[model samples]
Target: MKKIYITFLFAAISLFSSCDDWLTVEPKDMVTVDKALTTPEGYTSALVGVYQILQNVYNPGGFVMGSGVDTFANIYTEPSIGFSQSLNSAYNYNFSDTSYDNSSGAAFLQMYKAITNLNVILSSIETTEVLTAEQKNFVEGEARALRGFLHFDIWRIYGTAPDDNAGTSNLILPYSLEVSNEFIPYLNYNDYFANILSDLEQAKDMLSFSDPIIYYSNELLNVEGSIEEYEDLGWYNRQNRFNYYATLGALARVQLWMGNKEQAYEYAKEVVDAQNEDGTRKFRLGTSTDMGNTDLALFVEQLFGVETLGYDDTSYSSYTAHCVNSEYVLNQVYPSSSDIRKMNLFTTLTSNALVYNAQISLKYSLMSENDASAYKNFPIIRVSEMYLILVETAPTIAEAQTYYDTFANSRFDENVTLTEGNLQENILNQYTREFWAEGQIFYTYKRLSLTSLPFSGQEMNTDKYKIAIPSGETNSDL
Candidate 1:
């Protein structure tokens, strides 16, 4: 049996980057609650810290899963002969390999630690007097949303699917509401979903009252009509944080996972219905022209995303290793000869001095020299996904067709028609292309329980759909 343990002190250490110098402190195993949560700014700083950790979740490569990992949605192929030790077992689906234990174990610990930090902020918001009612609500809402989001992710990777599995009584992950170091027993699948929904609903309610666009309008310089007076309030970054729509998007996703089609459609509709004062959609679909000479224009389509500060180094390496020079996988994803993405979203190097000439995806690849770091933000959700959810849960074929057409027309010159018979399958295929390296493709396969995929030599196996719990936590009080 694998020995499991949770280090409260080490987890307590903040892994936030000190680039902004907002909450910089010496490296320590523990951070006292009073020192980090006494002031309103401190709470906000902690939230930023959470975003930093999230940005690092898949660094040196944006894909959370390893390249050529059969256990995951094997969309990309690496030309390299071998993978790092942390990803070897993942590639072969060998759960018993102790060498792969650290990768999952470290992520598990970090996610829980971030949850604990969010709980601390949530706890402090009620008592902290420095913040006004609006500030308190905004802070509390973002914290709860982050907490719910993280827990939902943990449940997806570690918890067995209640929909796919016949035996739904097994306990999976430790879902906690408090910041204590005590060992919380795992909840059944039903109870786990309940806990996740509870957090998300509370977050939605809190954020409904705060209204991120208006509340943070001063900080959003990119948008029109800058409120100069409120600009000094800090927290200027928009793409990195969980705004109102992001929270709603999370709710819609959770509802879909629970098989609540009506509720999912309702929430997704709310996201799609969101419009600016001028009647434009809050999030709009991208155009072929938006692909541009560089991928920088793609940022305008993000409903929610995280700015990867290490993009130049991390995303560049990951894209080159897995996608560039791998013609088979590249052709598999963007298979259509006339696909605009194949032409606009990719570029090939041709200099004789270069080591090799290969096509790399400009979507995730960063070009810092051109000041495209703003486009380096990784998308978590988009309006395009809202359309996908709407189509997936639409009651009528006509309604689903409308939603599908709205998205397809935006991306392709030819009108892609959808019939009720092939709606689900086509939606899955669209997901394969739409998300590409966005990380939702794997979850789509798992959620729908469909067997075949775009990966080379993929077989139908339900067990491979879910990742095994890392050895470090196998015997712990989970």
Candidate 2:
């Protein structure tokens, strides 16, 4: 029996009353679990609270995406002085250090905390009388999809790479499916992955018919309509939630991670080829026009994202505080000055007496004061990633090149060719260019089992790739 330290009873109750502007709910007075679960509105608020917990896990300067995991991949420069000791520790792969607790420790706990909330929702939804059949499907599908998504992220961060055969058989983390203090057993890599796939598949089946994202255009789905216009339902901001396509996208990502290339390609192709009723692409790549308008986060391409109100004012500051190597940014990541990302996604600070010229990412920074909310989204997955998956998993070199060319052309004015020899290298380069500061390049490095990292030339091994389970968790199990 594994005794994981989780605050279910109190934390789950508190989540019901907490409301955010994006969730579009008024704060409720704290009530008992039975009272809260009695209403359909309560279920929605509970789900919204799960998302809020997720924000903490992915919070700026925290572990998962922010500066923490990115440091392990050497995305940021080691400051000359000790400005951010925690970030420095992360860059050095010192996961066991107390200084790094806020990153790895907090993320691990919060992720499970969110999972517990999802289980609480799932446990009550089936028997709840307030929801119609369609509403039940809608809510259950979202909850299950989020459960799989968060678990997969936990596996990515703490467990060994799935390709590592010896590591795959070792017991790692527990896949929490119930809201109880009873001992939950840890699962090995294979069983854990099986559970992840099961949840995602079940969610996909449910969302396929019920989610409005299947029937509406991206424009109509994300519109900021009034509560009266949307009939006071939770259907307005479809992108922020885990909709049908997002479930498919997650399936694609998971399949690729497990090395099921054919299944991965099929799942990714579905997202890339999705269409509106009139035949417009459901989700298109971000264009020069988006760059020109200072839409740095590329709102149109985001398949799934979290809405962090005041992100520009809060998380943006901590994220940009970590600087990048100017030479690496110029020569390796973005070689072409004409590339859209180079032109808009980065800004360089000129040298002064104390420091050399430093390059910083503007991907999450506020470029427009008129509508700062537009830039507040934190992308979890996007259409561009689906295209990249297609490029990697296509049946043949010719087919892969076609997907690669389309994705490359969207970011650069000049034609980017893909040959059989450069296919793998080009894919890596695209990841660095596209996902910098987005907290994905490290996973790419681990998935491919590459020993050396770009820019930093840091040699890697399984120890560096797999973060240690926090001491609190390990101790609780004993």
Candidate 3:
């Protein structure tokens, strides 16, 4: 599908300002929320606006410094030229002054803006006369799911670890329930998690009847026909939206992060089992053959992602600047030829004399040659992540091995096997390989608090793990 650009005129919604506090602008919009949702087309357009923040956050070069989750996580390699210039603070954990720069701060601000828009859509949908109840539920489900997702990410970046039972007393962020400028105080980690999960559970119920993205084909055949085409019913590709399965996947991820092993395993197992053995599943793991002949490509059967319109044309240079000549990590960790990830998803640049052979991440940057592979939607969750969750949270080592081997067998050219003894070792290895440049590796280490990383000699350090609140937000002038 051609990437659709939904114009979110922030100027129109000046009431939802991108201010330091993110809430001190006039309520000026060319179209009001009630009028905007009066038609299905307008409703979809507004829904698309809620998704715009993902593209902004995932865009490689926009606010490299403020991209705290990946930057602080140390997800990329130090460039040959700017090893000390660019990412010096993040790599060294120097986030006191420079961590919350304008770009990073803007990312944090934009998510709130998106949430504000989502809140408007959710409140208006109840009284929206033009849309069917099913249509309203679809929009409500996606809005709540996206809200939960954005808030959860905010917590990850700013708050203490969810599993920190001791840190439950400290509040970090407010769960914004309505579109208002009122300063919401931070809830403790446990309370914050409860609110986020509550939204996700509501999302799951709302999207139960909604269509899902079919795995191998990446199509949404379920929502194709019979519905009144609102500007041709643009919702067919529900993969771009947070469908039912996506919420399940998110539940699995959140549960695992919170240290709830049994619940995490159950949720992940549900997502994994959502795919059919007969190949009719809404989502499944991609094969090496599925990656096609291109060296620069992303696995397209993503459970949840945002379609990035003109991403390659606009942001490729900025993305490569941070990634191209930097020290690539897969070179050190992925030593096996049987693993197809090294061959399909990664490309080596030997011309960089400083790093010798920098293995650049082609996960989201492969849109140059093939349009088919260029769906720049940053993947929020994937099928393999469920398998990884199961591996880490299973009740027994034997059960963990069952999950591990299923993933290993599918990813490798030759059949691969793992024993109970090597379960922890291999899970970390798989995390590095599977989530290489997708901005997940650091969280894996942070959540688990591993003393050492897989390839790099970087150990668990206090500076690297914590991100400071932006000075603007810290002011008592709310």
> TM-scores across all candidates?
0.85, 0.91, 0.83
Model 3, global lDDT: 0.63
lDDT of 1 at 335: 57
lDDT of each: 0.65, 0.77, 0.63
* Model 3 clashing residue pairs (backbone): 15-26, 66-104, 215-282, 306-377
Instruction: Kindly list the per-residue Cα lDDT of model 2 for residues 1-478, writing each as its tens digit.
Output: 4445554334344555544311323354233444576777677777777777776666445578766777778877764325666777788887766868655777787888788778878988868899889889989999999999989888888878866753355677888887776556778878888999999999999999988888888788667563343445557678888889999999999999999999999999999999999999999999989867767878789888877653443334333366466655555678776789888877665642223566767776663334644656778899999999999999998899888889988998346677778878888888888888788888889888888887778898988888788776663535
Give the per-residue lDDT digits (tens) of candidate 3, residues 101-212. 5445666667666777777777777777887877877788888888898787776666565445434465556676666544555676777788889999999888887543
Superposition error at 128 for model 3 (Å): 3.4
Report the Cα RMSD per candidate. Answer: 4.7, 3.3, 6.5
Sort by TM-score, top down from the best: 2, 1, 3
lDDT for 205 in candidate 2 is 92
RMSD of 3: 6.5
Query: Which stretches of model 1 miss by more than 4 angstroms?
Result: 1-5, 8-35, 58-71, 78-88, 214-225, 314-320, 323-329, 347-359, 367-373, 476-478
The candidate with the higher TM-score, 2 or 3, is 2
